[model samples]
Target: MLLEGSTANAVGSQTLDLHRTCTKASQIFSSPGENFIQNKDTVKYGELIVLGYNGSLANGDKGRRRSRLALTKRLKANGVKPDVIHHISTPLVSKALSNKGHHSISYTLSRSHSVIVEYTHDASTDMFQIGRSTESMIDFVVTDTAPSGGGSGGSAQSTISRYACRVICQRSPPYTARIYAAGFDSSRNIFLGERAAKWRTPDGLMDGLTTNGVLVMHPTGGFSEDSSPGVWREISVCGNVYALRESRSAQQRGKLVENETNVLQDGSLIDLCGATLLWRTTEGLRRTPTLKQLEALRQEINAARPQCPVGFNTLAFPSLAQREVVEKKQPWVYSNCGHVHGYHDWGFRKEKGGVERECPMCRRVGPYVPLWLGCEAGLYLDAGRPTHAFCPCGHVCSERTVRYWSQILLPHGTHAFHAACPFCGTWLTGGHEQIKLIFQGPVD
Candidate 1:
């Protein structure tokens, strides 16, 4: 069965407050007239942030190709719903109908017989498309995220579909959003060839899955420090949920999960095979640390004057903008024992791989790497002080943030899943995914 719409009532006065907050935030990026006229009147559904990016893209966020996208109610809704179904025997008729400038999904049952489901515009909801496509129909253009030190060059082939998925959000209060498998192309159509996984539902409606499929994992609890990872499921073209296929590109579909729906939650994780996205509702964002709060936390840590035991030099986390370049007073860590120190070339244990270094303080030998503050505020579960760090790749954040990400098993490739650092797409290593850093204060 298809997913049902949310029956929750309007958020009442919180809606006005949310509108005001969204308006205030939009003003920073938009002109005064545009901010007041275009933004203030609109309702913000939520935001979709791609994992791995610290804050912005490598070249910086440009147009729709940014690291994050805000799904706001458009002036005119452009969402589409399945309207008419046609079974055409002629190839020309199928081709002609798809090119008619209307949204559609074409399922090729065979060479001669094909089922085409036409869609009509939905005035009550706004639609946003995401994919690797550069087409105008896609609101957010995402590319494959390469793991740090993996040496997977930018020229590497991407597994992400050109038109991967689409999100339709209700325009009314309590703006519920639902995600579907494939997105409409520039011609306003989604075509599932015979080789693709297409089937007829019990209601006699046609449904299909994309080549790589669109997978979603909603957090068991709300998007908070206490939240746990939920079961990952595949979403069909009609927004029905199902268990994961045996393989990503398998011809057969998994069993239907009647209880679960395609309705997105605050901490929903959308994996598009190549890249993963984190969904944060406006209410959830309020609980997370803002950029200003993160900067304050950085200042608070630096104020304590954390010192290196060996070098006797005070170490400080570099500004978020200067994170790439290792600062002279930057703090380094022995990932195994969590001893914070200043950069040193010595203590490299040649016996246990040159990358492993013996910590001078604790005598624990482990992977030694520089500590980088996690800058993406949206990824944080709370505004707690930055304390713990992820192992292997030392991206530091709140204890809750580190704990949350360390427990998440993000989809790595087609079939495998692994825990990765959200700030950098580095796979977590060691017995424990994170460590509580022991920072030495100024001895003076």
Candidate 2:
């Protein structure tokens, strides 16, 4: 899809800046008893948290560019629904309709003929867009995330679309939220060219897909301790579910998944080619652990007084605030054997591809890396003890959390897919992506 025109004057007399309006709305609908009196009546749909960030971005959350964004009821509805369809033979008419400032989608069949679907305001729902674009229309701006919490600007060449996808949430009870493949650009228009994957449905309705496509996977159960990963399906511009394409950018669309729909559930994973997001419903979040609980867990682990078998030095996981810096006393794991020890200079083993270390206790040679506690509380499947760690990048989390993420495969680059550590975005290596920690107590 191609995006054209400048959005600077797109709104004409009215405000074209929904970004400012959304920021204000989120503030006004803040937690109860803070500032706004109507907070008691405010309804929160859910939250979209980008994978790989421990909590906030490396540079910190700024404006709409953040690790997580709360989808709440807007002061005024900004959603639009298809109201009128025009088959115009003239390019002048199509341009005029798009310039009207209202949201629209143009499907160019050929040079002489095209279809323009005009959208009217829908007061019952609110819309939020997610993409790599820094434009005002994108409610949540996301870029590719690198492993080890390097940050969103990790990739120089990103596959994420400028206007990747949009989500619409119903205003009333149930607060059903649905995701679509494409988003309206700065000029509030989505254009599907002739070569784009599009077709008419049996009922004679126009539907299409974005370039790389937007894929979603809902947990088999809900987002909980027992939850398991679901099948990954592609969502269309008209909110239809289908199987994944042969390749990421294949022109052919996949088979329609009649049993599945675009409605989002807790623990739903949305992959935008270059980046992936985890959707946590308000109800699901209530059941998950809070930051205070996670802090207490960290303190509990430190209180255990685990020591290195070789160095006999006490090791502690750093606080959540100290994200990037590795502490000398931090626990280092021999990921191959699940042995935990304090950081030491010895145990170096010669390897061909990368650094390798031989474990003093188990005599197993493998990647020895520092263990960092997964700070993002929302990613935790349960408040269970943080007993397991992900291989390669040893980010420790709850047993279920590590296991769940390790079993699921995410889109990498274009054609390749692999299971990655949700906390650090590192591709899991070897057969066992997750290993049980064997922490040693103080040798007295």
Candidate 3:
């Protein structure tokens, strides 16, 4: 029997016969044969090329002719004459998709038969009608039998028109989701959850998720391979998927899901069965960074420092742990002004583009070198160890000068400090700024 639209007034009788022949060819199930339809007449040519696909249903190739005929008829029924409908080859499918246009439609049977059609004319109202009706009308008959859920025909029909706006705007991977599940928390405490929500592809086929709803949280306290009856409902809005919390379930006492429903954004966190989990997109995984990119990052960091490494600044004081042993550790401290400080506490006053390092306490410009500010002359006569600190660049000043600089410097650079080396132009900071170096001892 001919399909509903097969005899529509828009399509000629010859086209209908070709569709019938193709349907018969599909039933025969022979191996793929040579192109049977090569006429130059646009409508006839489209029919024959589509019919070639009917001979053998290799992989996802079955029901292709039917879908093509159905789509053409649908377009024609809606008053949009398809100037041409070529059977895009499997190898050239990606290329065809790349060159897609607003008024063009490219439907092919590959892994999952894909239909991408855009409506640019004023007849979009009819296009919308066809898109909506054909969503249920289109069916891929595999081995002369239609598969469950209409066999990707629904996926093809529903996705194109629904996402045509996004496609025109050139937005990629248009849909996203955010999830908060306590099972994802490292501390296992759902209450103390992620600060930001994660984003992910809104494809409903993620493991325990389905067409209807997702297994909100398995009573087992973690994501399970098996799905529970109903914890959350998946709603499709303008081709984007969202998970809505179902009030029917009793497991909804978490901090993340206080509202009836949460619109999943790239960083929206959700609560699942008392566990807080963040939903994130896998776009990063799809784009793996190459080794060359990593090497360039390292090179960029190294270039920030001066070419000559010698005159670089070093940690001025003993380690934080050994502050008590300052007398023994740093013997050449510049302490004529009684200022003392460690590397982390030191900084520079902001200048135009950078900062200038100087003794804030006594107004002294110093790479303070060889100014002994240590234990008084016979305080540790028998002490075998030294009692003064020295800079890595051998520029030592009073210990009081360095310590005083820290007190005045830290407050100026609240988040971080930036100071240039007096002898060299290398920038320094307490922790890892752009460049940092801690000195164990005076550079010999």
Candidate 3 on 273-323: residue-level lDDT in tens? Answer: 111122222332123223343334333423333111122333233322222
311, model 1: CA deviation in Å?
Answer: 1.2
How do the residues 112-145 of candidate 1 rate in per-residue lDDT, one tens digit apiece?
A: 8787776665567677788887777777888888
Candidate 2 residue pairs that clash:
none
Sum up the clashes in candidate 2: 0
| Candidate 1 Cα outliers beyond 4 Å, as residue runs | 1-37, 149-156
Give lDDT tens digits, candidate 2, residues 35-76: 211477778899999998878888889988999988888777
Query: What lDDT score belongs to each candidate, Candidate 1 first?
Result: 0.81, 0.81, 0.24
Off-target runs (Cα >4 Å) in candidate 2 are: 1-40, 152-156, 351-354
Let me know the TM-score candidate 2 reaches against the reference structure.
0.90
For each candidate in turn, the TM-score is: 0.90, 0.90, 0.17
What's model 3's TM-score? 0.17
